[model samples]
Target chain A: MPRVDVELPSVLTGLLGVPRVVPVEASCLADALRELSELHPTIDVHLFDETGGFREHVLCFHNETNTRWLDGTDVALADGDRITIMQAVSGG
Target chain B: MGTTAVIGTAKGGFILRSDDRRTWSVEGPLFKGWKLTTTSRTPAGTYLAATASDVYGTAVHRSRDLAEWEQVETGPAWPAAAEGGGNGEARKLKQIWTFGHGGNRTYAGVDDAGLFASDDDGVSWTPVDGLNEHSTRSGWFPGAGGLCAHAVLVDPADPKRLWCGISAVGVFRSDDGGASWTPKNEGIPIVIEDKSCKDIGRCVHGMVADPKDANTIYRREHVGVFRTRDGGEHWERIEHGLPSWFGFPIVMDVPTNTLFLAPLESDEYRMPVDGRLSVYRSRDGGDSWEDASAGLPAEHAYVGVLRGAMAADQDGGVYLGTTGGQVYVSSDGADSWQTLPVTLPRVLSVEVYPS
Candidate 1:
């Protein structure tokens, strides 16, 4: 298992009382998110819709690289990697 | 509690508390940065509000004081495999429009056109699939406001009987405690002009059932205002003494049996008629209506009210929040109106506590 730090926007902090940065151990972005939710289960609704897809406005980046631009969330990840997530629009 | 108005807006939500209805103390922008679509004070005295976030979709928040909120993770939502028409975004539960209750059951009318029920107050939810999976669901479409089931009315005496109001999909009645449903848009004109849809397509903007008589009910539709005496079995146009037939909300002040509504210019130009925002009052149960816009703005107030933005406290008071971000209050049963001093956000819904 690889270790990574996930950074989330303040909206999640304000609504769900989750920390801005959380450290998790996972091998990929998908597992990283799963572990993140396992730690903070309430954040799942804010990140995904009922069908388990990323909410339309949610944006995920893996170390300054757009995760969606990559082939899949199953792409290999490395230790000390940083995953950044944010709402697509600032005021929206 | 004397009277409090829970106002849901495009930006957030507010609470106005008044003892005499003349002076109110303002408390919000609650659930900051989230759009407050609808609210309810459940029969068990629990405060529930639906908040929609750009990144988070929508969820239910519970409040005991109407100021502090607790997020309920298991709010009403469509299951993963339940398929709905339109794009993937449209297939999801986008917004909550109204909250209703009868006996121990609490009902939620929501966008994406579905009904949900809560047995243990509003903590958790289960979808009411009878109407959500109706035979005519394929033909159900969206109006300008999007496809939504915005009104849920359960008979006062009989919890088994229910009527749901949906935009562009028409009104549906459930007599078997929501196990089954049937379309009930007999006399209301369909929004789509050409091809006739036997059941769906009638856009119900606002609806209210009689406080006493279960048979009597009224709804403001996209085409016109209508009333049904035989429990929505058949309806008749009741747009007399009004400037235009097109309107958004119809609220009832139960004690007086008086009904109040606001009529817009027309469907093409949705604004107050002639730039004068007048609330029409029907003292004789929609037989005839009169302008009840005293103390309101006289000129250039061309704002429209949404279906859930206008509310009657069911006492002598009626409150309305406008698209212009202004709230007006009438304490004396629509006799006069006064605007609140604050301008917040585009108001989506105004819910009265203890209503």
Candidate 2:
């Protein structure tokens, strides 16, 4: 079995009152997100759009590159693969 | 003139007395410190005002004679809860975004949260259930700012039918007098990103459902104005004739179902468009629209209407207050308009009461 590391973006870190960490045994990234969303109920509404996918404001990165630009949720992760979720910023 | 009208302004609130539906006089700038958001007259002709006052938290006031006001307790001074572990004060009480009236029931939507109802005039309030507290409350998403409920429209014929607007979250309907809500965005368009990112519905600002025809609803989203004929089941976009896609206030005439909105240039952050202030009107239920500013100021005026700053009276009259501190009045049902007094402190909202 492969173990995955999860990280959060600076914008989303403090939003939830509790510490953000979850362990899952999913084979792919989508399965991991789905599982993590269920484990942490608070993130279910904030992170997912009406369509049930990661919100546009949220971005997931595998290592330093955006996982979105990669193979998407289907991208497989081996041991030590780090997943980070970041929120986009907009201002005047 | 025989109709008495209460108008909300930026610096001061005003009460206009009119008879024969013609001439008018401004009556007030009451409550010197706070800015007025919206005003609704109860069944007994008692005026109820939802205000953003610094001395008081968000409060509602009752005016028996339409001249003297008595303060009434409203709700949580701020949007977020004390235990929410978030910056509740940052948003504070921006405005009393909209008003809903039915029988003895009166509701006001405060910034950051929702419909606070007053059963006996505007003296006291309790949070309406289903519309405000969904299973999704824990995760209610905020737009650029924190979460807030702006628009509240109650069916005059059926007070049980309620519709509330949440910015960036679409519209919610409560058939059981706001006990529970169902998202009415099935036919509404949402901006979905590509494979990786998902998109929510557009941020809704102001909405008006026909007082007579519950099925006809008009909404002004951050993107543009849309009309829903089937009680919000499906929406048809009507952005072709407007100056800008972004705007705040939308007023409707009950008799004709005509819709009026102030259009600004496209700015997701809700900024004035190219410094132009234009009011557009749709006569046939938003199918087609026309610019309705005949005697109003120039487009370069940079006057932008805020969330609750535009209102329509029972006499086919429309009024709008702007962020630049200005007010415009349309006596002929928003077909044409003229500037009223000079601008004042950012006008948060506007309401007109006609007797």
Judged by DockQ, which candidate is best? 1
What is the Cα-based TM-score of model 2? 0.70
Lowest lDDT 10-residue stretch of candidate 1 chain B = B81-90
lDDT of 2 at A7: 72
lDDT of 2 by residue, B85-187 (tens): 1232333344566666876787877665556787777666776656555554443456653356887777778888878888766788888877788878655
lDDT of 2 at B165: 84
Please list the C-alpha lDDT of all candidates, in the order they appear.
Answer: 0.86, 0.65
TM-score of chain A of each: 0.90, 0.76
Q: What pairs collide in candidate 1?
A: none
Worst 10 residues of 2 chain B by lDDT: B81-90
For all predicted structures, in order, the TM-scores are: 0.95, 0.70
Candidate of highest lDDT: 1
Report the Cα RMSD per candidate. 2.1, 15.3
Collision count for each candidate, in order: 0, 15
